[model samples]
Target: MLNGLTDAGSYLQGVSTLQNRTVILSLNGNYMAAGDSYYDGLAALGICYEDYQKGGAWIFENGVPTLYLSGKEYSQKYPIKDGEIYVKSELHNEDCEDTELILNGKNYSFVENGLNILIYDQDTKQVIDHAGTDIYVSFEMIREEKGE
Candidate 1:
């Protein structure tokens, strides 16, 4: 029937894109996959981290992650997913007390080790984690190096 065919087409489309789509993520206390609303927020900030080589960065301040681009401050958001303490706006900034935003008992900057950037823990000063592979960032850098 016509209804059956339509359902099959929809299912196939979902399967194809869902498996290979590249998600745009923003780093807070954890990695966040940006949805349409988040992209709108980023646009409001007037900076885009969607590209590599011109990728944005985050600086933790007062237990909050302030977003940056090209070494300048942009906007920030607080996203709470699956009970992890991610960044928040000023209204909920006080709620960060439950989260260990402090690195090694004090604030620390991200350390660059070649192409990888490491974030340290507040109490131990050990490399707690780093961002996942940002393909756009890598591609942009490669393009720049070749002067293309």
Candidate 2:
């Protein structure tokens, strides 16, 4: 009886995680969001896109789709559910071979090699929560915004 209850609890938890709309940022290539490095509009912000040494992977999952920076030694394990997934995100990085975001499934992630964000209007409620329905996934390929 206790075991059955525990299993049911797990099932419910999984459902909540799947249905919840959110963003998951999992970065693998060199990330340079901080002020230590500077960039200009004409020039590209240099990061680990080409020189990813291929030993480590970055994974971030709070309440959204899962992502993976797969390699020969390492691979990400996905869930079995729809929002949560199970199978193979299996791919090599730009360092080893060409990288593709998805082989199968909806592009709900809207993920890119650089950064992904959420955009929404402030009229409905001011600051929008991650789970709110008014948000849109915005992927910034390069840090070329005006005024730095």
Candidate 3:
């Protein structure tokens, strides 16, 4: 029952399973995917591969693949599921007083004095303040794309 992309940081932390799938992204982004073999070597964090059709590009390194989406490398080692929750956090300034957050793929850039906030959730499409929380997202919520 996972939803959509929740928070970036939390989602990255909570990925459990890995599978082969196609990721449709903007022309300027990269995609990654991971299968059973890739997940076995990971004891803590995992790595995945991503492919981009528009660019006719496939990046593979050490049996892991990755794609740069929107100027960021989206790791395929992490599995995404529907109704899953995720969060992304960014510093507002060098002072570290203000914070910008993204949850469930949505963006929130008006948080102040917020630390380790729950920025996104795929299932609920909601972003909340996660001060001292560690959440994991299930890989069953993502749909498998064709030709992946």
Candidate 4:
């Protein structure tokens, strides 16, 4: 049985089998996969990954991802799961049709921006109270044209 941690790398691991999930480790270097089971087992302990050198904690609670900044949980909204990641460049390359997002060769034509995305039913095409991220991208938010 492992006791309290004394170092960062003591609890972090780079495992190939986990794919996108952040692999954690027991104090004795046992690999722990990310999932609800681990969360349930460790939730009360606030099982956070602290970057002592950088000053922050990466948290995953109830399948919702968040960043603990300044001791507060700030949600990092992302809903894409279990699919091939399609970046903005690929969206451009595919010449994505207006109002249509093709993921895995299927059309998902509805989207609403929220902390997490809300993609609606395929047939109804109306925003449902759910979350999804078939298309994910990162870009700077600019208020005015550059070089103006």
Task: Give the range of the ten consecutive residues with the poorest summed lDDT in model 3.
Answer: 23-32
Model 1, position 113: C-alpha lDDT score: 15
Q: How close is candidate 2 to the true structure, as a TM-score?
A: 0.28
Clashing pairs in 1: 52-136, 52-137, 78-87, 78-88, 103-122, 104-121, 104-122, 104-123, 105-122
lDDT of 3 by residue, 23-100 (tens): 211211111222222222222223322322211212222223443322222222223345322222233344332222
| TM-score, ranked from best to worst | 2, 1, 3, 4
Tens digits of per-residue lDDT, candidate 1, 1-148, equal: 1112222223222222222111122333212322222233333333354632333444332223344423122333333222222221121342221111222233222212112122433333343333222222321111112221
lDDT of each: 0.27, 0.27, 0.27, 0.24
User: RMSD in angstroms, all models?
Assistant: 16.3, 15.9, 14.4, 18.0
lDDT of 3 at 141: 20
Q: Which stretches of candidate 2 lie over 4 Å from their true place?
A: 1-19, 33-73, 83-113, 116-148
Clashing pairs in 4: none
Count of clashes in candidate 3: 42
For candidate 1, which ten residues in a row score worst on lDDT? Answer: 139-148
Q: Which is the better candidate, 1 or 3, if ranked by TM-score?
A: 1
Candidate 1: residue 103 lDDT (0-100): 26
